[model samples]
Target chain A: MPSSSSSSAPTPAAPSKMYADDVSVVVVLLDANPFFWSSAASPLPFSSFLSHVLPFLNSVLLMNQMNQLVVIATGRNYCDYIYDSSAPTNRKTGNGKMTALSCDLVAKLEEFVVKDEKLGKGESNGAVMSSLLSGSLSMALCFIQRIFRSGTFHPHPRILCLHGSPDGPEQYVAIMNAIFSAQRSMVPIDSCYIGALNSAFLQQASYITGGVYLKPQLMDGLLQYLTTVFATDLHSRAFLQLPKSVGVDFRASCFCHKKTIDMGYICSVCISIFCKHHKKCLTCGSVFGQAQSDAASETNKRKTIRT
Target chain B: MPEVRIVARNFMDMVASLPAMKLDQLYQNAFICQAIVRSLPPLAKKYVIQMLYVEEVVPGKLIEEWVLPDGSTKYRVAIDRLVQLRIFSETFDRTSGTSYRLNPTFRVNLQKHITIGGVLPREPMSATITVRLPSLEDLEVYAHEQWECFLLQLINSAQSERMTNISPAMMRIFQRGLLTQREKDAPRLTESGFQFLLMDTNAQLWYIIREYILNSEELDIDSADLIAFLLELSFHATGEAYNMNTLDEIQRITIKDLADLGLVKLQQGRKDSWFIPTKLATNLSVSLTDSSARKEGFIVVETNFRMYAYSTSKLHCEILRLFSRIEYQLPNLIVGAITKESLYSAFENGITAEQIVSFLQQNAHPRVAERIPSVPENVTDQIRLWEADLNRVEMTPAHFYDEFPSRDVFEAACDFARECGGLLWEDSKKMRLAVKTEVHMQMREHLRGQR
Candidate 1:
């Protein structure tokens, strides 16, 4: 703000600081779990999902010309960078009405899902349980760090995770790491849960990063949920009366069984969680006496609520 | 206390004043559309994007529903700004409510930009037109060197020998317009010139650029053409030199002139010359650069009234001389003191104390910049006090009259002067009065009528 002018002052306004702002960068993390698309409970088919998401992404880019979009696909055993607008991808469709970006993002997503379906059909039952959500998140963080390193001043970067799979406890540590970094960097992770069940980790991720966590009951209205709740950037989020989750699942997954637990005994040395009290900590190998382990279980049980 | 209305005008104030066709030409260019989009408030940007794909003029009521009911004020402001920029036009009907439609050209251009990205910037330079231009770092240095020299030449005409062929018109825009030039060729700061000197570089550039745009007609170029070309330059790859031969005829001429302002750097190549858009050129349309914020002023002021400026440019030194008494100057340092006499000269030339204080605070050295208040409070207060000294007791042109006929007559005369609205001062105790010079004859005529 310019200093207040005196009585004799003749409207000396500050010259417009036209080119002194940060550009908006959006990283779209599309969850391409083949298992979820094939599931009977899922209302969004792969093609329908792509059709709706493509236009939503188009509107995101069209929202602001300076808004840079990066699409990442997280599949069963793979997380890949689908498309980045920063790189020149001029592969237009038959007609020029739609951007090569929209077409390429859809095509690449299709290829990713098909490739994942083949892999999922193979002798890998464990892959069905996970969608590489943690890996995709870490990759998004790395990409954001790369952008920041390039000296783009505080480009309003955000991550919108169109999640479909249930949270995998095996990748809990990595996901938490990504979540912490996202929190530190002030990049919100908005999660749109269209899956059958609620994802605790995704809820926590959104909550920690101050991003919206919307779980629309009707999967057919995926586009509306995304375009309305998640379309806004960090700046506009200030004024928006966004739909916020009433509660965040705060349960920790114990290291011993790698299970989400309501009550967990912590290893005194490293704070590693365990479903059952152990004399020797499973993570750090620190030994607590049998009596101490018994006492720890007693306190853990006392802390657990009946609900 | 500047008039509150003064703060209401801003950069877009001029754009709104432009003729409808001229403003339409501006929105026709994708770069201008993008630039205008970038300048909008975040909420307004959201409104534009939501309306971008809509087919027809959406009713304002329908558009208002996009945001939450609580965000109505923000929505109103966004629509208002969009209308002011001519991005959205309001349509009215006898039966229906107000509606807004995106300007057709702006809508088409902005849509095209999103679909194809930056249209390869007017076709790629031919493979045969390979020009080895200076590196980005070297180009930035060149820009600064040229810009400082240009500004220095304006301050001290003797420095013109070292400077290159500057646009005489740009020089006149700065000197002949702002400063009063005597027949002998010496220029003194006019009231506005002092204010201009105190402004930050960005404001100074805009001040001059707006003047240039206003004078674009004199240059025989359409104002819209000048605006479109300049805004399009922002889309140019900054530091990555573009072939000069690729520029259109108008751009070819404009690019060379822009080089004088350090907005673009014209490099010499063995085969053909190329132009590298500097940060200044690229940052022309949008206020979104990190470099401009951090790399502006470097001055340190002490409570003792001494000033140390960490600048090697002659431009900085000459600008300091505007309001400070220069003690001495080293290679990369200038030591100066704020004195009553120096400030009086500045105040006399229409420089305000606030401008001077802000100039110091804005340019405070890095060490002092970290402090909450960059400049010491006492110094700012003292500078303001000195300025107040000049205007505290205003001089009025009036005649003093004493020893009136009687108390009743004196009181009646005072009332008459009050009615005429020309009474400067009146002392009822001594029966002395002062009447404005213009009202002197009228009051005298009234007094004769009273007798």
Candidate 2:
């Protein structure tokens, strides 16, 4: 028996071969972290990250004719829209308004970070995760709706990047909600923690959204990472090696204390989450007021039986 | 057959979810469409972006002023194409309307794209170094193999070859509707089968996968899963292995077929612990401009109709033999001639002249490809003439009309037929006409009452 393997190295029959010719939509979530950017001006600064990211963005533009890119800046206040090459008005501005807008948005994000860090002391990193998630997501949904509504068919092969940390629980919840929404929309989320000190939310965002999550060790070589791994558009990535994330932190933050934990108690009435020690749920106002007393009595009965 | 139609309709329903535009209208009206499509200039994309957010019609004159005088025509053409494509919406503003604003969708995306200086960087991906998962390679391989197997099934079933190397489950799927099984286990190929074989790899793959997707619904596979898997497969690189455990159940079953077609290699048994994706699998979603695909071009054609293929693989020889009359084969070169007999033989074998010509044109030798006309015009003309010769019996099955109410009625029917491209023959003297399609029959009936 030839055993199938030895039957003359299978020839790549032209007519019988499969070819890649798809358009992938890449949504890059620009971190609105003016705090980390302001704190560091050197090796791992915002400028450094941009220098790394822009080329990868260009590579995606070069990947396929149908490929589209969406940029959303997550910052304080409203999340600003940065870019989407597929949109009609963005393609024809004679005055370079889109570029101006992007520069302005990034600048604004930086300015907010600087202002927030100078005014407040600690734990107030001006990272507005909600705005970023909401803004980028709204744009993506709009684009998708346009695709679905237009009589001519448009295939959406997608890659989404959440680039920084969530500011707090609200931002975390919003980002999580966005991840689920993206999942429902069939958009895969790929996330990067460029200068995130504690971005457990983004890590979960990536995990839930079927996106690749990366935390770079050598922060300076950000571009190399983007190009080699993320730069591979949905089509090109098929033929090129890609890096995969390992050991994701699946922990969630409790709604009561807003602490990241592996296990937590849930309120039966309103589905409010709590990390041990609360008789009544703060979010839902559900009462298990006598739970501690009941537990003590049960333990006392067990002691009596043993005696 | 009805079952197949149902499958096809469901598949189309999924495709219906995407954005749509009439290509003809898009090219004629939108300038931005032309610019982005032909890669005119960075300024064109910029112009489109600026106009997207604004709700006013920027006058054509203002557009002229916005762009440099020398590049005015380019910008105009770009705008024209975009408007034609409906990607850009044009409206005449009644109040101080000097220019056109960009459409909302285009404006939003373009603003976002150009802002970060044209798309956000894909760098510093989350899974960088220190601890990268090893199973991605397996997933990549599994994806490739699954796709290739589908292609091979198309070929083997068409040829009716006794190749059991492919899995039985895949065979059943092919038999089901993905591929129309041969009447017998004979070595002959049918018309549809041969036509499938003559198409370019890209088109062929699309056809097979489309068929596979249509058939997947019957297999209890979610259409979304198929679409996602197909899209995801496009992201894996050739020669790399991916974790098999990462694949969904339907995909796990599909990978076996891919390995059989040389699209990928399976490391172990039914579970397939690790698999390596081949070039075919990795390039499944890539467009022609992709450098890796361009680099793989091995066939070189000559204007004199002499052909030389650089591949030593038997597969190349087999494909070449489909049209070319092979003279001899060497370690690295296979010499062939494009004779009239060979062309007719190919036509008889269900190959079209266009396919043969395109195949040669696509794989033209690097030397010839650099020329202004990749393949000599004479050779192209010859191929077409040969195919034309075979189609000498010009005939169309049509409905005839002899009795007409008046010349006007007959003329009206004739005009409608001409517009529909269905008029085969006509005689104004007898008030008679012949239309080559049934669609015109109803059209003629509608014209009768009006006349």
| Top TM-score hit | 1
State the lDDT of candidate 2 residue by residue for B141-180, as single tens digits: 5544454445454445343333536556655655443234
> What is the per-residue lDDT of model 2 for residues A94-136, given as tens digits with 9 covering 90 to 100?
2233343345435555665565445455545444333345555
lDDT of each: 0.73, 0.55
Best-fitting candidate, scored by DockQ:
1
Report the C-alpha displacement of residue B127, candidate 2, in angstroms.
14
Tens-place lDDT per residue, model 1, A30-123, is 8887777788757778778876677677657645556688999999878889988777544422134555677677677778878776766656
Off by over 4 Å in 2: A1-307, B1-153, B157-203, B236-241, B261-264, B268-272, B276-282, B288-292, B295-307, B367-381, B396-451
Task: Estimate how well candidate 1 is docked, as a DockQ score.
Answer: 0.21
Interface RMSD of 2: 14.9
lDDT (C-alpha) at residue B423 in model 2: 83
Give the clash count for model 2: 99
